[model samples]
Target: MAELAFCLPDLPDVRDFATAQAVQSGMSEEALADFLVAVNEVATNAVTHGHPTAKAVLRMWSVGRVLVVEIHDEGRWTPETPPGQTPPAPHATSGMGLWVARMVSSDIRFETGAAGTFITMSFKV
Candidate 1:
């Protein structure tokens, strides 16, 4: 397992952390690309949309051939629409992250409460 505690300005480092963990899990070249895409999108949302002054934690682990990543943030955001359920409009500029995450990752889950929000994604490595 690997973990990184990051802030908004540490987005690049978040990618590095996730890349390293995915490599260690024996992810394939093609799969790694998709995995990073999802990681970048989710991590961006984590640091930017989460609570002010909040610290985000990213965790990566493997179970058999599955690679699991969890991004946890100290925020209580209610989604305006069900996230990752549909792709963004063709002309839309933003709001593409969640939908893209769903397309590339095998499984994506969201949870929020007084503790914060947890986005758990899984990839088959």
Candidate 2:
């Protein structure tokens, strides 16, 4: 098992994490691209919606053959439309982030509260 942890202030850090993870994994260029996209989508969501002053701790570890990443944010979470249903058009932008995450990640689990939000996304690495 391998694990990495980082506390990121904003978007750039998110991109850097993606790059570092790809390089460290020695993944194919194509897989790296997907990882980058996934990280951006999730990190952006946390920064833009969850918390502005909050710090995000990203942790990655291997479980057997799968790669798992957990993103924890110290920010309040607002209620949104449920998954797998068409949300209102005005709220489309909010949902797109999650949609992108789902596209690239093999699995995702999220828990939110007044204190903060925690998200875990897994990939078949």
Candidate 3:
């Protein structure tokens, strides 16, 4: 497993770290680009929206042919609408990250409680 501890300032670091792990996990060229985009978006959401103190952790690993990347924030939240269920309106200024994540990742799930929010995204390797 590969892991990174990050905050808002570390957003760019998150992408660099995750991209390296995804490549090692054997993600295809096209998929890897999309996967990195998804990873960045989710990581951004975790720190900026989920955590009051802006701390988050990201972990990546592989099981069989699937690559899994998970982001965990330090606060609890449940969205008013299921995240990524629909695209944001054109005039909307934000909330497009999760939607982009869902479009690219093979699957995604959310688990939130008093501990925090964990977003697990899977990609075809």
Candidate 4:
């Protein structure tokens, strides 16, 4: 597995780095696009909603045909439901990041506690 630990200002760089790694690891074109979108959404949420001065850690690996990416943050924020489980109101605009992540990834898991929040997303390569 490869990992990137970053601060808020490093968000864009991390996105590009993750995408490049995914491509090198053999993710298909279509899957790469989806993975990029998903990772961006999660990483953005980590920086914006997480505790002040929080940092994020992103890890990735490929097991056979599956590509897994995990994003973690050292923050106390916890969602009432796993992101994307509930659809926001029609007029809502800001809460859809996790929803989009869920739609693009093959599977997603979350863990939150006093330590922080961790989001693991898997994709079919």
Which candidate tops lDDT?
1
Please give the RMSD to the true structure for each candidate, in Å: 1.1, 3.6, 1.3, 1.4
Candidate 1 vs candidate 2: which has greater lDDT? 1
Higher lDDT: candidate 3 or 4?
A: 3
Candidate 1 residue lDDT tens string, 20-107: 8999999998898889999999989988899889889999999999999999999887887769898789899989998999999999
- Location of the lowest summed lDDT over 10 successive residues in candidate 1: 75-84
Off by over 4 Å in 1: none
Task: Give the residue spans of candidate 4 off by over 4 A.
Answer: none
Give the worst 10-residue stretch by lDDT in candidate 3.
Answer: 46-55
**What does the lDDT read for residue 66 in candidate 2?**
67
Off by over 4 Å in 3: none
Q: Which regions of candidate 2 are displaced past 4 Å?
A: 1-9, 78-94
Which is superior by lDDT, 1 or 3?
Answer: 1
The best-first sequence of candidates by TM-score reads 1, 3, 4, 2
Q: Against the true structure, what is each candidate's TM-score?
A: 0.95, 0.73, 0.93, 0.91
lDDT of 3 by residue, 35-103 (tens): 888999999888888767667999998999999999999788767877898998989998899999999
| Candidates 1 and 3, the one with greater TM-score | 1
Model 3 alpha-carbon miss at residue 95, Å:
0.8
lDDT of 2 by residue, 26-119 (tens): 5567777777777777776666665666566677776765677777777755557543234336646456666677778888887888658877
- How many angstroms is residue 87 displaced in model 2 relative to the true structure, after the best TM-score fit? 8.4
Superposition error at 94 for model 4 (Å):
0.5
